[model samples]
Target: MFTLTTLVLGLLTATGISSAQSGADGTGGIMAGLITPHAYVQKRVSSYDRTGANADAIHIAAGATATILDESGPGIITHIWFTIASPEDLHLKKLVLRMYWDDESSPSVEAPIGDFFGLGLGQYFLYESAPLSVAPDKALNAFFQMPFRKKARITVTNQGQEDVDSFYYNIDYRAYSQPLPSDTLYFHAEYRQATPAKGWTTDWKSNGDPLVNDKKNLNGDGNYVWMEATGRGHFVGVTMSVLQNQDGWWGEGDDMFFVDGEKTPSINGTGTEDYFLGAWDFGSHPFSYASFGAPVKGEELAGSRSSVYRFHLDSPIPFTRSFKATIEHGHANARSDNMFSVAYWYQTEPHAAFPPLPSVEERIPRIYPVGGPGNAGKNP
Candidate 1:
């Protein structure tokens, strides 16, 4: 069976009546004919031989930025691969990714490079999911399909204190001869973080029953919002990292999704682990699935950290007017952990404005122990 993402993309890209809607009225696919054979074009944007030598990679000075890929479209970014030689984890959080679609001055996508590629906590571990993966020795891969009608620009900004002396990447995209359909959606990824999440300190466990003393939050007010936007699109899911602040499970919080500006969420999950498609505190095992996985499920302890992701490839949450995707910091919004997340979605161009990227000081993935004070979460 085709995943909903596959089905939607296939239907969206169909060449006429073949479920690939290549042009106007679906008749264009047939009229274009199979004899001429549609042409496919490809290009790679990489750190390669910039100075007439075989040496690749770029040395991005601290606080400087590089335009890695800039192309006129009627094209789709098919695959992206990246790896940094630096050993520090902070670089992952410091190096940001930004993409502009079809002449939009502001970015439609903005996030930390690592977080955007699934290492949300600024650390890398070998893991895989349908849309993203990590290989041995810190290789990062992303398979999100990004379609553009007029133009696409991708850049990497290094906000770190140390210069990135070695940065390698390959961005692969395919160019199309015809214009993309009007309904085709643009890709988006946004990042958010709240170290030592401002949660209740009273340890109000709900005993796993949502109805137990849970009457206060009808609007998901205190939930850790992964992404919120006003637009027409579908929620692709998120990359999440939870640095435990208490000695108990950090996933008792629920996943709540409010669509179309509803006061109450229409899609509510059972628990944080449930939203990530895990059970029993993720079994303390690193695992991957077709649509979801906890690639980095650290030890179940205070200060322990884990990275998890869920891709709604099967059924992306569709929203016509707006979307607010959030999850609790702890059961009943009671534990103050370090929460970092990147939300992925697809919508038409001119997307809702994104909040400013958090400062490097704020983006650092530090661990905060329960009841600790003053940036306990800022250091591991």
Candidate 2:
């Protein structure tokens, strides 16, 4: 019988203070408890679908507890390991690892544990025939390696159907003051465009022409737009938001995103979803949309005026002189204006290879309007 009392006790007992531990060097030394082992047991709802709609579902009574054992690191985290124990066989689709940094307001970083490494998404990451090999009473173990900074809290989420009665985890981490080889960097550029008429359609071009006129024209009004930094570091994560005026064109038509020299894929949904790197949409709404996809192009169609957009890179990116964005297409109803705003950030180091691109299922679409009478037959 797993109770809250047991869970709390588990955490407390697992976190016994380390009186003194030997340093990496054989020389005698005294180290604080910073590198000591810490543990936590928590109950969470398994809610995430990796595959299609037919994916398995997780149905467990609320308050099922999971014990997480964590070891602190010096600076960058090298790897993590854990195990899961369940009363019955459970179909797991995916696993999410979230890190709560010193700042409790939000997690420093959160990603699918399997996907973070080379492991594929969802059950695919698991070995076929054998989901995982864990004895009834024994603890299963796994490992994860990544470049990390500062202290962090990690959480494992089960996305598979079936009930996970209980589980235990042991995470091993190595920290160092030396930065990783790959560090993320961020840069910003400003763009502005003007159109001929109030209802005229135009494309907001980045390199070729400031004003573009074609079926894909997107920038409507002539105002200053801004792009901000959402994610940064060696595993450079990029995200931005767009604030625009007017509303007519479909959500897909008016948004665009460009990385390096090529354009990214588009995302599904509206508002922030349409915005690149936007993880949360439907602000202050009844329903919550938590779909994550690869980066995509964005455009603005309906709303004009000033809109903010964002971009994210999974790894450290080279320092380029400039990056650009443009409105692919816009509506012909109200005049649409587009502008660009910029911000800058720096990474500690660079990575060996360019970050991996997102999968098709994880791709996000550009920004566009949804569920409005004015937005009809406006996408290109």
Scored by TM-score, the top model is: 1
Per-candidate TM-score against the hidden true structure: 0.85, 0.31
Candidates' lDDT values, in order? 0.77, 0.30
The list of candidate 2 runs beyond 4 A from truth reads: 1-70, 81-96, 111-122, 125-150, 157-170, 175-228, 231-315, 318-380
Off by over 4 Å in 1: 1-38, 50-52, 87-89, 203-216, 369-380
Q: Please write out the lDDT profile of model 1 over residues 10-69, one tens digit for every residue.
A: 533322222122133443433444444344477778888878997798888888989988
lDDT of 2 by residue, 42-77 (tens): 222222344666433333333332324233322323
Roughly what TM-score does model 2 have, to 2 decimal places?
A: 0.31
Error of 2 at 22 (Å): 33
Model 2: residue 216 alpha-carbon error in angstroms: 2.3
